[model samples]
Target: MKILITGANGLLGQKLVGLLAEKEVEIIATGKGNSRLPNPDTFTYVTMDICNANEVMETIKTHQPDVIVNTAAMTQVDQCETEKEACWDLNVNAVEHLIKASEANNAFLLHLSTDFIFDGADGPYDEEASANPLSYYGESKLAAEELLQKSNIRWAIARTVLVYGIAHDMSRSNIILWVKNSIEQGKDLKIVDDQWRTPTLAEDLAMGCWLIAEKQAEGVFNISGKDLLTPYDMAMMTCDYFQLDKSYIEKVDGSIFQQTAKRPAKTGFNINKAREILGYEPHSFEEGIKILHEQISAQ
Candidate 1:
């Protein structure tokens, strides 16, 4: 199968590229910047700014891939809150471009969504749950999902939460890495106890996307880690895994931090739909930590 993946430099995109590298498939990997993937021969790299409709059209036409997995977005919650126009452009407008282009090309699309679409009034949502987003980021993502539903094309939305793993030259750090690094360096860290999530392993998310592509699954699927854990629990687990001093980790509530964006108190996913329909099973948080450790250690 021929696949075109956007945001190939990001965590999920890089994981998809790596996984597909081992398969007998052609990959067209596009990112906003130069490709950071080490395996040059694994996929063809294309520089694309999806917000530009022209670039989107050109990239889609050139590849005409059987599947397009769009992982690109302005995912930083605070950044999305501050840069509303930029967020909407990337998250919603670009999706419109992709939907039109994908429909024209007859390519199946597998788009990524987040758990933030829910207000966290109640959590562990399935695909059937109603959305009531509180933040601009969540609103933007939900808008994109709405667009996909309207577009008369084959598509699937894979909603995940707290995706954590190592990627090549990544600017962001996952909770496990952050906790392990901070504690080892003797830096005191304040982790929030109020917020809870089913922190997804990046590999598992990539696999979920792959499953969507391989099966050509339509509609929405919740693809995330099975364990619902608070940030404090994650920190403690990270400390335990690394045998680091947990004393440096101070548990705090959301009240103390003055974040630009309002975070959902608890947004976990019910993955029974994914498991039953796609045969998807995610790794436990501890296993995810161990896998992350292995990757970082090898690096």
Candidate 2:
């Protein structure tokens, strides 16, 4: 099978490229620039912007991939709140372009979405729950999902949360890097105790997405980690796993942190649909932290 992955240099995209290498599938990886990911010689690399509909369509037409996994997005929550137009262009408009290309090429689209669509008024949301996004980023993602539903195309939308892992670009911000940096610097960390989520390991999420895509699963699915915890809890687990000083970690309420975007207080998903449909069983937060520590130490 020929597969094309957008945002190939990202945390989830890089891992997906690595995981699919052993599957005997043809992989075509694309990024926004000339940066290439570490892969076998069989993998193809393309540098193009998804926002350019004509370029994206041309690339898809040339590749003629059976599946197109879109991992590209403007993921910064606070930044999206301030730059609404840019956020919509990338998150919503770019998706519309990709959907159009996928339809033209007769390829299945695997779109990566976020769990921030919930308003946090509802805890541990299931697939049947209503989406009441509190931020512009979530609103844009929801709008994109709605567009896909109305579009006449074969697709799967995976709503994941709190993804963190090593990436080609270390400059990218994630929860794991934030905690690791705080511990390495011996600085006091103030983590939000009230903001809850099922923090997913990027590796696990990548595998789940590949499974769903390969199976040609349709509609929306909530694919995230099994364990639910707050940012403070995650920091404490990281400190424990890495043998860092736990005293440096302090708890803070989410309401106190003034931000341009309003974050959901409790955004964990049930993920029962993923478990039953895709047979996906994600690792716990502790296990995820241990694996991350081992990976970092090995590097």
Candidate 3:
């Protein structure tokens, strides 16, 4: 099987590329800028920006992949709120382009989505739950999901929550790293206890996407960690794992931090459907931390 991955330079995309490389499938890794992968020669790499309609169409046409895994999007909540047009163009319009190209090639399109699609009034949402996005980022993601639902092509959406993991290039810093760094430096950290999520490991999310592509699954799948935790919970866990002082961590509510985008107080996913259907088993939150620690230490 041949797979074309967009945003290959990103955390999920890079993870997907590395995971698929060990398998029998062919990989076509495409990103917006120059390739930042550890070994660019391992697979076919293309510099195709998904925001460009012509480029997206032409790239898909050229590769003619069996499956197209789209992990690219403008995900910064505040940035999406302030720059609405760019958000829609990448999150919604670019998806339209991929859907069109997928239909033309009759390829399976597996797109990555987010837990932000739901309002925090409810917790642990299933695949069939109603969507009430609170912010522009969530709205744009929901719009893209709507496009796929109405389309005729074979498609699947893997919606995840607060994904955290160390990437190959160390270009991204997640909650684990942030908390670890602050606490290790003896700096007091203020974490919001109100906002809750089923924080996902990036590797687990990548595996979920691979399962969707491998099975040619259709419809939406809630792929995330099973633990429902707040930022303060995660911070304390990091402290315990790294043997740091918990006194340096201050638990606070969401209102303390002023931000442009309004975050949902609680948005966690119920991954029972994925577990039953795809045989998906993700690492526990503690196990995920250990894995990250090992990776960080290795580097």
TM-score to native of every candidate shown: 0.98, 0.96, 0.99
Off by over 4 Å in 3: none
What ranges in model 2 sit over 4 Å off?
none
Instruction: Identify the candidate with maximal lDDT.
Output: 3
Better candidate number, 2 or 3, judged by TM-score: 3
lDDT of 1 by residue, 85-153 (tens): 999999999999999899989999999999999999889788999999989999999999999999999
Residue 70 error, candidate 1, Å: 0.5
lDDT of 2 by residue, 197-283 (tens): 998988889988988888989989988988889988888877777787888877889877889998888988898888998999888
* Pairwise TM-score winner, candidates 1 and 3: 3
Tell me how candidate 1 scores on lDDT. Answer: 0.92
Query: RMSD (Cα, Å) of candidate 1?
Result: 1.0
Instruction: Go through the candidates in order and give the clash count of each.
Output: 0, 0, 0
Lowest summed lDDT across 10 adjacent residues in model 2 is found at: 168-177
Best-to-worst lDDT order? 3, 1, 2
Model 1 clashing residue pairs (backbone): none
**Most TM-score-accurate candidate:** 3
The CA lDDT at 148 in model 2 is 92
* Candidate 3 to truth, TM: 0.99
